[model samples]
Target chain A: MDQKRKDSASRSRRRFLTDSTAIIGGAVAAAAAPAGALADDKAPSNGNLPPNVPEWMKAPGADVGSQPYGTPSPFEKNVIRNIPKNQPQYTSSASRTPIQDLDGIITPNGLFYERHHGGIPEIDPAQHRLMIHGLVDKPLVLTVEDVRRFPSQSRIHFLECSGNPSYTAMKGKTASDLVGLVSCGEWTGVPLKILLQEAGIKPGAKWVIAEGADAAAMTRSIPIEKCLDDAMIVYSQNGERLRPAQGYPLRVFLPGFEGNMNIKWVRRLHITDEPVYSREETSKYTDLLPSGKARQFTFYMEAKSIITRPSGTQKIEKGFNEITGIAWSGHGKIAKVDVSVDGGKSWKAATLQEPVLTRALTRFRLPWTWDGSPVVIMSRATDETGYVQPSFEELTKPRGLNSFYHNNAIMRWQIAANGEVTNGNA
Target chain B: MATLKVAFAAAMLSLGMSATASAQTHYGIGRPATAAEIAGWNIDINREGTNLPPGSGNVAHGREVFEAQCSSCHGNKGEGGIGDKLVGGQGTLASAKPIKTVGSYWPYATTLFDYIRRAMPLNAPQSLSNDDVYALSAYLLSLNGIVPDTATLDAKSLAAIKMPNRDGFVADPRPDVKDKRCMKDCKP
Candidate 1:
């Protein structure tokens, strides 16, 4: 009886494979093809040829449990995160993501951009405790286990630093340093409103001050409107427990808010009537303008886009290729993105990839046939609220050169006749 | 199978509807926090002068604390070295290369007291006594010419002193710049 069932299953499997061979034959033949191919349809120029039978394939590789945790290949070692240029101290510095080397929307947890105020503190989850007090009717302290026991949701959202391209600071910076301050991840957590309601948010509560347990004791005042809307008490990122560099045990995750406001190693949430103008909010994150006034509490990262492929310091040949990159917004979903091959003179509609979630990175692509002529390439994104991303000149009009944070201006890259691309925004 | 799917979805829909009502459907997960626990972590300072500890320090003691604790990173005169510049930069917000120092652009004086008490001296955060934080705030205020050398800061006095750029901050005026969905013949 078992043999007959197994035989029927084998016949169905053979039939399914045979029927699909005609359509995706080459993909099915991937077993005979090289394991990986370079993006530009070229093999490794270092003579790692197919007929040569590379050394690794000639012998048995390392045993199964050799390295329990997975890692990037040694050849991909250079694809790691890097410290920003001119960062003075390692303790309070940033490790930016290499955007150009990555594809798709999700950034690997290991390669996600990290900006630490007091270096990574080795936090034991058992010792971690989150307190909710201030204007609440009943203040409550919750352990990590108690926090996890609440109804949780997984949301994919992008976390961006308010410090921005400010593009002045990133003048000569290339791909890794270009947009390294932003990354997207699926955060699993309980909504902050649930916790707030549990504490019986008092009538006077309008702003909640989130405080971290780091050496800097980083703190920021979040408006209650945002807290009830999409703020989360995240304990997990990209499926696994939060990485140590990314707040580990717990952190406050406010979708569409600035990175610094998503207080890491979060310990306390004090609901109050007024915004606590902490150093991170008032003095540092404030946006200074030309009229001697600065924009305070600028929480949302506006609509922005960048062409990662053929970006700064890249070489591409003249041929048919797809121009691809990522576009995102904090106000909501990316309603549309346009790609301009001849600078701002003209633009063509880009195809937004499927599953364009709100407050998440949306990959966009446009087909192009390059005739090897010198031209400017860039992208412009418009959010669901119809806020079109402005050019550098347009952005500089209202916000003077003094405004360093919240710069979401359109980025441009110049492709020379030699097929080399470099920074064209400046 | 189809009936089971419909039943499951109906249950989920009812569950979601109850979540919106919110008040009656408490999970009752976390326990009530103790006064001692709240006091230990309730360190944030609001601009309304509330929550400041009951201690005072004058500019004289402030200088000693500044020189010993802060001046290593922030310069002796608060001009900034390894840390951010805490003094000077007055009237520079509109100029090119605007040096936004505490005297020039910080909107509230209470933030200084709050930041120092919660996180300061880089190496030792929350290590400063409430009185020492008040002293450091007074010293910086005097150095920035915002207060007299004899000025002392208690919880009341520190929150009372208004920063020079008190009215210098504006709410987010975004959609501040605009452009259209021009596909071709766009202006350069």
Candidate 2:
């Protein structure tokens, strides 16, 4: 879809949802059903139960091409992104993907959380170009077509904002509001090494400053080691040309780096000996510590996970419950995910849903019996590298709460006797 | 899954043992960039003043530009409004509410110029002349008391004006916090 249409659709979806209560009812209904609610002693039949065939089964469903590009069910209209509230401006704002409402790994392109500095730009592929210069034998300026001409590879990776969990107004917030600045998807593009090798890297080039074409002309200095390692000049997200907001024609995808340095709408790659301390690298994105020294080039996103179902806002009825969440590590694949009930007092290993791709979100689920008592529940993910996801206290001790970015702390949700789930995390 | 990952790791390790990577085969696509083309898109300015463009600006000119172009979002004195606060907040990094403005926290002066040149005025970024950006940088730096009010900045002057917090940055010392695998009766 074009930028204009995509934007309108997004706005309309948000508008319709905000004005309707059916969406809220649907969400509560969604949580109540899907396995756990099967044993509920309430009246089973409400006209659509097993005895009576649902209205949909009695009639022919919509034929193919009804929605040529395809859209989610109308009932799922409220499963849209949470636009950043009270942002300074819409152009330089970020959005939260409704992660709580999603399952599996691949984030739909339209639903991918957006973090644009200068908003989305509609770039014509024919006119767009990517330049690679500085300390290279061949300083190449390739068109989008030329970029596609090179050999390409696809990888499933999780793109997370360093400032994920930027949500501050935690009261009554859903999991989406808590840790929504992250999404996992398949990125298809030419490995940057191939392009850089074609350009022939001259010695002494230690850093590459990737520049974006948005109004901000956003730029970030990336270590040349990362650029040549697993960096990619991605054109396709999931299986399609990237949604305009997700950096249309092209963008840089550093496999495990923090999202800011990924440089969406990437236009230029300038190899240099020293890091370019851009506004982003210095004035922003850096982590301030209690020692008064800010940590620079803090690229890797550490391991993090959150219990999506029964997390915040969502309610659960007594009886058998299925606890599910997502876990990921920038270093590599997740080694294990342990879910804890009774507020971290005891833990049980959750079954990790398979094809747990590296640097991508891994789905994990565990069966539980609620017993109708109040309890605090949470999940902890240990990465393959032996780095366990830290608690808020542990996380804040070293980095401090003001560090703001890279909040990979474990989240807790309190399940009351009445089935209301609330934020147990401070 | 753990076994699968281990097998995958072993295979990667073995592959690493015999890898002689890179350009045995080039698709021969993407022609070399022209000098003019390189100059057009090459807008990044490094901390060491590598890509600083020509032209100069002063605090006086920067003040005018700030009032005209920048102050709308950054506030009258860059104390911040819709945009971020760019001045003051000096020596508050270790404090509870560290206001991390450009003067107080930014390690290099060049970052200010680069940011203003590329993304200032919010509405019309990259429209600022290099001189205007330099002037704005000088003015903001002066407001933060890092530079003299009369100081003019070109590539050299801007690079030479060592920011107060230049040494305030350290390499990322991460994996700093470790979560022990505490299953039951954990420390609360």
Candidate 3:
């Protein structure tokens, strides 16, 4: 390391140590590279070996104000959301996080998966207004400042697109390609019930229609019961203000619901007696069954889990390897996750990491000794509701293969004799 | 379900506390919305044609608007160029290549009007007039062989038309998968 880099690293190290207790979910796990080990193979290219004075120690660094806002280290450039190449012309599309590259439960703000309708809208917070009308005693219009004035609450939760695992059933897909559509974050906002109470909802109000201010003016009808039950109008994501792609200024946060129901760029809430049955809810998110019948208002994303390390596109040595992954449920906390190294013939419970929060991504890990033979590794997550992650066969048996949304099947990664891992079904 | 009950209890407790707090001194947070402001943005139209604007359009006018504004993405014949294929795929839902087009899978005709009104023409969303949206819906429906080219679609007619898959949707019947948490002999 050069003098400037050394100084900066030391400063960061000091701050990291001091801010340990104040640190939120998965920050410590994110920084969990053993100090002595070089994170990359390129460490040999630079003459910064042990007993030699590092190059970064020879010069002074740039001033702090040089960058008004900081970004992740350049070494972490590979951690990115990957948009599939097929939908280049569809303005409203989704991109997946590189879940295979992540270390812990909390997805970094930059790498969080994005699913937008009518593209991302750049809204001026000053000009924006959130209107609450219909079936309310007081139809109020709240400014961004007025929204922040309410008593705030912060909660860590996971958001998954209901259509996440649909496109990955085909052969030859990577782990990130399979399960990268889900992400976790520490979301900060005011509880939605407080505002709804202030609005004085009418006795007959059953649904709350949340509308985004994007070009699509995207709309979804949420049950008023769910709104009072842990829904939040969030302004900040992770530790900072949300990225524009992640709905800057504000969004409706329905904990554990499908990502679309947690409407982004939110600006209006119209309480009504019935669901709007919008295009998304009826034509898109609904699950079609083998009987030609579809299931609508399937808001919850259900319990799901996927192994990240040694997943597809990764090669491993045939010895001691740690099988680590994340599991979460829209219903509630992940109660337990079982790992099946020999396909599903036998299973072992993985150790759940600390701070396993309700409806948040919980990290799970287990040690396995590879016998230098081909074997399939899979994980089954059981939520607090006692709902186990279903196999692809089990899922398709009831809902059929025609449904495009809510495919929360257990993913299987096959380890080859040559020490490469791939999707078993794929 | 128990979690939902617990959350409801918490919400009630918080609401009670805030109600007492409001009694002492009002936060006086948000301003009351004006009638004009409400009328300007409250543009949602339900399946009952509750909030649709007064408009009427024909297939001929719809073809003209779609070509001018939507052809870049939806193709000239609504066969899909860059956007999703809008026609065909009827009765293919149970087949191997089940293409979910506007005609094949959509459960409601109002959804077609609603989606086009709010989020269609990809590049210029919400840029279509209510009449143009009605025209577009007529044209698309005609292409799907659901309506005649001579038919004019207004709010009432649009809501009245039943979609091909109108009765295809069922309510969610969950807890579909059952497991006994076996540690051994899990798979035979």
Candidate 4:
């Protein structure tokens, strides 16, 4: 029965891909062709399945009630965020989707990466209200409905936890095992500037204190200019209301900022003249230098790229393989992604997927023939700002060992002669 | 060449053993943390002394420490330069334009100690001793007029110290009871 289900699922997926591709091709052809060529191209026809089908295929009767809520397909039950146990009460370590195991950038909401400081807060959306107080002209209290009423916009972007690759920084580790705390999805929400405009900011409002409604009451003081710029109060992910783990009903989405700055379960936006000196901003997220002067407010995540397939854990049987992965930058669009198979000795540019927007995940793919020999693979991304992703040595050189956060170094995966994979640096 | 090969083998074997040992050991390597080590590290003191260390200090001694250690960043009178303004500007929260200095905005007294001990001095973080941290906390608190000049601040007295803006903050009551139950029914 499991085999049959698998077969059906594979067939359906193939059909979906083929049909979608054909439809897209036809649309493109029709648009490019002359007016008289319209009838020459016909839309694909749908046919009913044979009557002698499985019981599950039969239409649900009145006894089977309709479901108001939805869940992921049962076939995808195994796909889940793997949370590594540390101390009790502290879920400090977690990993997201094995992106190599999946196709397409839209990670299923259930399988999204999670990194929680305390734990996921069980927040009731109905009871959640966002208060805009402090340096605002009018301290406005907004319900979820009030937010939804505003003109909404949808954007596709990746939210990657900053501590995504701390495990692999040591080297010789598999790619996904090291830095799997990243997931990309289409986020839908209202621009934060619109709401801030509604509230009317005072002249002295330089910093805005964003506080979360959780046991930790996580808070961060974001710059007022950023709030007025591209900040989003997102409510939906991939055409559905956000999952509880992904900040349920409402979350602050600051494009280009590190994931920590994107406050989840948002409760209040206090417009203050100065920073609140929150624990996250001051102590946790701040980068401690060897010189003792810590680098605080390192908000913008620098450009970085990784070759996902033919990476650490996934095996390739010494033949033609497509090296695919994601490249993104908080600064701007990924101008180029260079992949080096022979360590950093030489580099070849990878083909970047289309529509590479600023502060968005740009997918890159490279075709390579793997001989059954030991080889090191790495990818380096250069953003529009002309800042190239540094090597681990280069990143650590100036910062020294005291540095903990914001280590966007080039990752290396070593393919042993025996086909076993290990971290190159280790 | 034979000696080099043997050395390489030994190094590889040691690497393997270390990896195995790392897998077995739960916490990262270091001496088992003593009470002194824990106390030495966990000296974070918030404005209300949420995690103040066990030590006593007075404003006079605090002022001396502040001048020697803190005055480079914060001015002599706690008027901030490169760092932050730590004193004056009280009761400015509700004004059209509020000067939200430490005296005005901070809701807890313990937060001062927490901030100072964790990352302060602008040059060296976690460098101050417990007594130094307490003195700095007292100095900052007295400068802000939260505590008297002669008042001693320690773990015991720090939590008891009331902040001016302590009552300013309120628990969020949004997504109210009405909102929670209003899914099916409307107002009569």
Alpha-carbon RMSD of each model: 8.8, 8.6, 7.5, 24.2
Q: Candidate 2 or 3, higher lDDT?
A: 2
Please state the Cα-based DockQ of model 3 relative to the true two-chain complex. 0.41
Q: lDDT (0-100) at residue A229 of candidate 3?
A: 74
Order candidates by TM-score, high to low: 2, 1, 3, 4
Kindly list the per-residue Cα lDDT of model 2 for residues A1-426, writing each as its tens digit. Answer: 999999988886666555445544655676555433443335664555666675455434454585788877655667789886776679888888899989898898888998988879999988898999997877888999999989899999999998887424344378888888899999999999888878877767788889998999999998877876789999999899988888879999997789999888889998888888888988788888888888888999999999999788788888889999999999999999999988998888999999988999999999998999899999999999999998888888888767878888888999989999988975
Over 4 Å off, model 4:
A1-77, A91-93, A167-172, B1-188
RMSD (CA, angstroms), candidate 1: 8.8
lDDT of each residue in A1-426, candidate 3, tens digit only: 899999989998676555543342333443555422343535665455555565445444445685688877544545668878866654688889888888888898988898887889999999999999998888999998999999999999998888877733545367778878888999999888888877876667888999999988899999877887799999999979877888889999999899999888899999888888798888788877766677888888889999998798788898899999999999999999999999888999999999899999999999999989999999989999899888887778877787878888888998989998888874
User: Candidate 2 vs candidate 4: which has greater lDDT?
Assistant: 2
Task: List DockQ for all candidates.
Answer: 0.42, 0.47, 0.41, 0.02
Candidate 1 chain A lowest-lDDT run of ten: A32-41
Better of 2 and 4 by DockQ: 2
Q: Per-residue lDDT of B22-134 in model 1, one digit per residue for the tens? A: 23236788889999888777877878777789999999999999999989889899999988888988888899878888898888898998888777777878888888988
- Rate residue A419 of model 2 by lDDT: 93
Better of 1 and 3 by TM-score: 1
For TM-score, candidate 3 versus 4, the one ahead is: 3
Descending-DockQ candidate ranking = 2, 1, 3, 4
Candidate 2 yields a Cα-based lDDT of 0.84
TM-score of chain A of 4: 0.82
TM-score versus the correct structure, for each prediction = 0.88, 0.89, 0.88, 0.62
* Residue A55 shift from truth in candidate 4, angstroms: 13
> A328-424, model 4: which lDDT tens digit per residue?
8887899988888887777778998888887888889989998888898888888887778777666766555544666677777888887766677
